[model samples]
Target chain A: MSEESDETLLKRLAAGEERAARFLLARYLPRVLALAQRMLGSRSEAEDVAQEVFLRIWKQAARWQPGGARFSTWVHRVTSNLCIDRLRVRKSAPLEDAALIADPAPGAESRVAEAEQSARVAAALQSLPERQRLALILVHYQELGNRETAEIMDCTVEAVEALLTRARKGLKDLLLKDAAFDAPVKAVSGERQ
Target chain B: MSAAGLDEQRLSELLAAYGADAARWPEEEAGALAGHPDLKSKIAKERALDEMLNAFKVEAPDAALSARILAARPGREMRHGTGVWRALMSALWPEGPVWVPMGTCAAALLFGLYIGASGALTAMSSDPQTETALLSLAMADSVLEENWDE
Candidate 1:
């Protein structure tokens, strides 16, 4: 049930209660998928990572000790580590091979503008260094505390803060540049109209 | 530090790291930064960036992906109360109660003991000279050609 804690659900899962696995997947799959998508910038790869993460959960559920990190934190840690490993392998591949953000279905003008903005933001995020990007994702997007983010990154809180500081500054600069680039294109389009 | 005590530099650092939302800041420090006079300009700048970042929305995983993930879960055999030992037991004797195999083992042990005891008693009841000859023959390194013929 939604009222049950994650640890309890894990215990139930270990007991072979199918509902517990479903509950956990519903609660965490979205977040895990999103984190991987942001980290890898590809939906298919993110899905692969999500499947792997859940498989590990199923394998570890029986052995999971409740006294250490919270279940949610451990899930994030697993997902983050898996993404990092894939990114390392991807480093050797051509940058252009990374999938572009899929465009949202067409709708109102405002929706279109929002999607464009979202794409640009995603691109800017992808441009950041791995650690900085992870810090931002864990803190800003994932809504984890600096301390928890530090644990996931295997670094101190101070280091997380440092990474966040630089991440924000760098993101701001990238968005500003993107805006500047968009200005000329928009101006030309406006003139044609 | 108190709200009034929070300096501009520290506030700026917190804003940059945690964004314009005071709620996202460290619990101990959030109260100090909230409603502070110096936060007006800096908060506005960070809020703009936050708004921009918020534009990047990630949709929930589709049903297909969720199904795929759920399908990959460890099988029922691996669950508690049905581990490797249980699996092995099931493989060795797939049907009937556990007591069946156990009873079979017990029966075999008793049968072997009965045979040994009966054989020993029969040999003891034999003529004394013949019993001695049998004992000597059993201890010999090799049976002679005459014994084999017998």
Candidate 2:
């Protein structure tokens, strides 16, 4: 049914329904891919991680317990865990995977300033400890609630708040290092008006 | 309960800790700073940080990725088994490289053989008394050997 819920679709998927699988892929793939790309900073690795995640979903669909957790939350937790594991591996074997950071900037050099800014931010983001980066990505980018993020990170809501504070401060310090604090938010707000 | 709100100091702390997004600020303190002109300047600073954070974006995945992943789904049928077999299969045959199953199978076979062979060897070499009453027989034999020397 067009109105079918994720839990219903999962039940159908467990029954080996191809259409159910397609529905899920269409529904969640982009979000998962974005999450992976943001976390890993590499398109190829992100795709690999996304594919692995779905494959796991397919295998585990049959045993999925619906009410225990929302399917989206479960999917996010899996994606985060996979990304973290890959990051840890890359940390230990830096030489082998160190070349993945050369993410191609979209559009041409006409937007050189914007491209440089994005690159600087991405680099600073990548420089954060995995947990801190994860905290920012989950709350700021992914827009997950503190409760959901705490569940994903296996920490308390207070801990998530603390993480957010630390991550925001860390990013601000890094951005400030480049002398990019040209003006405060008020100036930007005035300009926006 | 007189609709009290956060003062400048508390407002700045909230902004610094939660960024400029009032939506993310603690609900109780969120409206506390509302309509307060004094904190507007501080709120703007927080929004600046949020904008800086928003500058980074992830590129959309290529369309082909969905197709590729869908195509690679495990074949249609999922087999069920006895509880022990299911646990064993899931652990040893987790979905991964084709080689993992082979490696685990080989390891499990080797382990099984080692245990089986060692058990058979023990059974073969064990004296009847040792097999039937190992602790008592060993202790009695040790005492007998010591008494013989006496």
Candidate 3:
């Protein structure tokens, strides 16, 4: 039933109930995918990460004991750790390989501008140190409370707050610089016109 | 300056971390910073950044992705049976052919029926040599005495 808790669903899942797995996938797959997508910035990689995350969950369901970390928190923690590991691997990848992960295509003129802005924001987010990026993503994008974000990150609440402060400041500076550069280009085009 | 009595420095920290939305702030701190004329400009700045961050919207996962993830679950095949007997069979022996267990049960039943119908136990008990062999196996001593009086 829709009212069933995650723990109950997991117990059913351990008993090999297909419906429970479907329910869990319906509830968490999108959120998990979004978290992975935001962290990895590549849809394919995000999908791989999501697959691994669910695989872990399926394996863990049989052994999962209640009264420990909440299921959602554990999911977030798993996703965060996997993303961080992938990011570490990406760090060793070639720069040209990094450019191969393309952004989504733009449609209309306004859409193009919006897509570019979104790309810039995503790039700024990726540029942040992993912890700061994760902290921001968990709290800002994932809409988790600071306490939960702290739990996911395995840090103190104060540490999460500090990471977020730096993350926001860093993101702001990057976007502001981008806007400043765009201004000069617009001014130059105006002068030519 | 606010209802919660938050100082300017603390308010700035909250704004930088949680942005302009009071809903996102801690319960004790939410709405305490709103409507403060002095903090309006500060809130406006954080709001601008939040708007930029909000632009990076991730699309929902496609059906193919969900299918792939679902396929990775363990014991997926075990969930397919609807019949109680079929489920019991699968639980009893998850792998190999169904005929394997069926044949085993059939062999056991036939052997049991054969033993019952043949009166094998009574025949074995009446034979003196069989009894003597059985008693020797059961007893620790090898010495046997013949009953000449019988």
Each model's lDDT: 0.79, 0.72, 0.78
> Could you give candidate 2's per-residue lDDT for residues A1-193 as a string of tens digits?
3568998888888876667888888888888887887778777888999999999999888898866988888889999999999987886765323223625655876776666666677776776677877877887888777788889988987777777766676776767544434433221011100
Q: Estimate, for each residue in A73-181, the C-alpha lDDT of model 1 and write its tens digit.
A: 9999999999999988988987643326533454787688787777778777777788888999998889998888888889998899988888887777767545432
Candidate 3 lDDT over B1-150, as tens digits, reads: 454798788988999899998777766678778557887766777888888999887778889887777767766555444578666776775433456778999999999999897886686657788777777768954565434334
DockQ of 2: 0.20
DockQ of 1: 0.25
**Leading candidate by lDDT:** 1
**iRMS of candidate 2, Å:** 5.7
Candidate 1 docking quality: incorrect, acceptable, medium or high: acceptable
Q: Which stretches of model 1 miss by more than 4 angstroms?
A: A97-99, A102-110, A177-193, B2-4, B77-150
Chain B of candidate 2 versus the native chain B: what TM-score?
A: 0.41
Worst 10 residues of 3 chain B by lDDT: B141-150
Report residue A32 deviation for candidate 1 (angstroms).
Answer: 0.4
Number of the top-ranking candidate, with TM-score as the measure: 3
Residue-level lDDT of model 2, residues B1-150, one tens digit each, is 222645666666667667778677656665666677877656665677788777766666666887788767775323324477655664664432335567888999999999999999987898986675666565675764566698
Candidate 3 Cα outliers beyond 4 Å, as residue runs: A96-102, A107-110, A177-193, B1-3, B79-150
